[model samples]
Target: MKQGGDLLSLVGYQLQQANLRLETDARAVLADFDLTPAKLTALILIRDNPGCDQTTLGRALSINRSSAMKLVNILVEKRLIERQPGRDLRTNALVLLPEGQRQVDAMLAAVHRSDTRMTARLSREDIQTLHNLLTRLGPATGAAED
Candidate 1:
């Protein structure tokens, strides 16, 4: 088979390029919600883990404490999420406000639209196969556990 070069043949390079495009598209789609991918992730994580704190959120998203704080602050300022006293006096539990819940649904719908557009070129079977291969490489759900 003909190949452009070793650089073009590298799986990591290809994946990185794909990720950049997807992130750009996701950011555009998320714009109407006034959310970035990190912020959207923060909201989703908080929703899924209602009692989780800032430190947990940072670790889950592979971001530093300051970065986490920035995202948290924005969400709080927007009244989309709130911080309440946690089990530990020093920690604050993150919870979505009513507005956050409504925004979450809208954001999810927008993201689904982006996903549909992105995958329009792939058949259902092809997409399934790609998902299976990716899971074998590194399962998205299990990454945090590791």
Candidate 2:
């Protein structure tokens, strides 16, 4: 394939292109569960960190408080997650419901399959190197684990 000259050489452009492709595959995988990437990520995070409040989850996702609240509300409506009283009276602790757990477990496997298929062209070493390089390019500020 012919490279697009200077644009092809730009890291941001390359990352965007890669993200578009990965997101497309992810969307397809998530469709089976009727979820968006954000929702699935929220579910997984809630499952892993039971009793975590929306503020912490929002910070981890790099989203604002309002957006996080809206996401949480949607999940609550779907019966996928619940909000209980938090450590403070002002906050609500996020917890994944049984149905959410079941969905997340299946979704994890589907996402893994999708990722493996997408990276099939690369060897295991190549994938590892790519992951390491990407990690190095991540934010300098302490952000949530990828």
Number of the top-ranking candidate, with lDDT as the measure: 2
Candidate 2: global Cα-lDDT?
Answer: 0.92
State in Å the error of residue 85, model 2.
0.6
Compute each candidate's TM-score over C-alphas.
Answer: 0.89, 0.90
What does candidate 2's lDDT look like per residue over 1-146, in tens digits? 67778988899999999999998999999997888888899998999999999999999889999999999999999899999999988999999999989889999899999999999999999999999999888887686666
Every candidate's lDDT: 0.89, 0.92
**The candidate that achieves the highest TM-score relative to the unseen native structure:** 2
Give the Cα error of residue 36 in candidate 1, in Å: 0.5
lDDT of 1 by residue, 8-74 (tens): 9899888887788888999999988778978888899999999799999999999999988998999
lDDT over C-alpha atoms for residue 37 of model 1: 78
Q: Give the TM-score of candidate 1.
A: 0.89
